[model samples]
Target: MEAPRLTTKTFHLQHGTSVYELHLKRLEADRVQLRGTKISNPEGSKALDEVEAHVQQRGNEIVLKTANGPHRAIAVRTARGVWVSLGERTAFFEFARKDVDAVSTQPVKTEIHAPMTGKIVDVRVKPNQKVGLGDILVIMEAMKMEFKLEAPMEALIESVGCEKGQLVDLGQLLVQLKTLDNKKA
Candidate 1:
C-alpha cells in the first residue's frame, strides 16, 4: 500500500538562544523530509547551514539520515513544546501551531494542556492539591507511547479537566492551576 501524502508545516524551534525555522513533510508512512534554516544566531557561535534530512520514527526514537550519516534522537511532545534529546544534549523547542506563521511561547504556567490526542491513563492531581515544578500531573498514551505531563511551576491545582481513561485532543486544557506565589492562574 502506498503511504498518504502529508502537508508541509513550518515550525520555529529554539535551542539555547538560537532559533531555527523547519519545514517538515512526510514522504512516506515512516519517512519524512525536513528543511531547516537558522533564523536567529547569537554571538559566540556559527549559524546552522541550510539542512535537509530524511527522518524515520522507531518506536519512541527517531533516526535522521543526512549526508553526514544517520543520527538518532528522541522527541517528546509536551503541553508547551517538544523536547528533543540528541546524544548528550536536550533542548525544548516551543512550537508554532501547524501551518501557522506565529510562535507560541510558554503558555500561562498555571495551565496544563494535552500535548497530543491521547487517552488519559492517569490524572495525578486534584483541585487544591499542591504540586511542585516537575511533578507529574497527568499521564497519557498516544500512538502506544506514554507521556508524563509535568508541572511547569509550583502551583495548586485549581481544577481537573480530564479523568483517567478519557481521551483528549491535542491542545485541550487538561488542568488549571494557581501559582503558589500569588501569581495568576
Candidate 2:
C-alpha cells in the first residue's frame, strides 16, 4: 500500500502594498485548510493573529468557512499569478514559490494582461502616458468585487486595448508598455 500524500503549498500574496503568507494543506477528501498571516499592512501595525479557514471550491466559486462565518469567493488563475475576490475585496497576487524572491525574481515585461475575466471599471492611462511603479493603471470588477491593476515598474504606455465597462478575459492583453529606459520601443 502507498502512504497517503502529505503535501503543503506555500504562497505569498500581495494585496495593494500588503503581503500575506499562506499555507494550504489538504485535511480530507474534497476539503482543504488554509492558515495565513499578514506579512505587512499599509494602514497600521504589521502583527496579525493567524487566520484559519476550511475551503472548498464549487464550480467557479470558492466557499470558505471560518470562525466568522461562510464566505463566498472567486479565484482565477492567470499566467503570472492568481486573481481572488472575497466579499467586496478583490486582489491579484503575484505568485512565487517559497524558494524564490517574489520581488527580485520577476523579469521585466512589456504587456499588462487582465488578471481575471471581469469588466473594466476604469482606465487611468492612455498612449504615451508615463507611469511610476505601483501606480494604478486600471480597475476591474468580478464577482461583485473590484480589483486594481497597478504598474509593476516605471513605464510608458504604448497602447491601451481596453476601455471603461469593457469585458475582458483572463490573460487578455489590456495594455502594452515600454520600460522607462526603453521608452522609444
Candidate 3:
C-alpha cells in the first residue's frame, strides 16, 4: 500500500486580511514552503512576501531568521486552536484536523514535545504540579543557545516524561498536562 499524505490548511496574514489555503509540503525539516494562492486581497495583489527563512526549533520555542531579522516564536496546540507567538506579537488561529488535508498521514496528540534534539538543562515542574499559563517547564540547551519551554495554558502536570541531563530526541514528548479550568474545554 502507498503511504498517505498529510496537509495543513491555515490563513496567513496578508497585508491586513487572512488568506486561507492548504499547506502541502515542508521543504526542509523546519522550513515549509506551501503550494497555494490567495484571492481575498485585491484582484491581482500578491498575497505573501517571498520569504526565505531558516527555522530552528528548540523545545517549544521556534527561532526564525530571515532577511528582515530574527524572530522568536512559540507554538502550542490548545483545545481551541493553535497559538503562535512571534516575538512580542501573538495571534490565535483555529484549525480542524479534518480541515487539514494531511490528517490521514499524521498523528495528533496534546503532549508538548521537543522540537529538536537537545540536552535538558532543567526540568522545572514535577508530575501533577499545578502550573499557570506561560509557566516555564523545561530548559533545553542546543547549538549553544538556551531555550525555555513554556506552558501553553494553565494545567496540572500529568507527567514529565524526560529528566534533567537527559538527551531528548526531536519530537520526543517532554511533558504532559491536564487542561485546567482557565483553558477552553
Candidate 4:
C-alpha cells in the first residue's frame, strides 16, 4: 500500500445559473487550497478568491476547517456525478469542460429555476397546465429533505424543463410559465 497521490484539478461549479471555476490542490498533509472564479456572471464583473483549508477524515464523515470555521460534510461519488452534504444541505456537481455552458444573457421573468442543486423527485404539472399562485409545481430532494417549489403567480405552464429523478443545478430552469392573460399566437 502507498500514500494516495494528490494533484491539481479545476472545475466549474454551477450554483443556479452562476458557474464558478474552481482550482483545487493539496499543499501539505491533510491541507489544501481552493481558488474560485465566477465564470457565468453576464455582468462581466468577476472576482475570485483563494481559501486555505484543512481536512480531517473520520470514517464516513469529513471535517473541513476553513477561515470561517469547521464544517462537516459527506461526499458520495457515483457514475452520474458527485453528491456532497454539508450539515442539513446537500449539493450535486458534475465536471465541466472548457466550453462554457451557453446561457441566455437576457433576464427571465417566467422561468422557474432551482434555488439549490437537488434531485427532482416529482413534477406536479405538465406542459400547458394551468396553475394558481402557491400551486406546487415541482418537488425536489436534498440532504434527506424534500422541498416543494410553487408558482409565484397564476400562470399556464408553457414547458417543463425537468423530469423525475433528474439532477438539476441551482438556477437551472425547471419550468417556464406564462401568465394566463398572456395568450400566445
What is candidate 1's local distance difference test score? 0.78
Q: Give the Cα-based TM-score of candidate 2 against the true structure.
A: 0.46
Give the count of colliding residue pairs in each prediction.
Answer: 0, 0, 2, 2
Which of 3 and 4 is ahead in lDDT? 4
Query: lDDT tens digits, residues 69-144, model 4?
Result: 9999998766645678998888887655545545324233688999899999999999989999999999999888
The model with the greatest TM-score is 4
Cα lDDT, model 2, residue 162: 98
C-alpha TM-scores of all predictions: 0.45, 0.46, 0.44, 0.50
Best by lDDT: 4
| Cα lDDT, model 2, residue 15 | 59
Better of 1 and 2 by lDDT: 2
Candidate 2 residue lDDT tens string, 33-112: 67666544324324355556677787769888878999999999888788889889988897655533453334477899
| Candidates sorted on lDDT, descending | 4, 2, 1, 3
TM-score (C-alpha, index-matched) for candidate 1: 0.45
- Show the lowest summed lDDT stretch of 10 residues, model 2: 39-48
Query: Model 1, range 12-65, lDDT digits (tens) per residue?
Result: 766655566777777766666676665432232234455567777877698988
CA deviation > 4 Å runs, candidate 4: 1-6, 58-60, 101-185
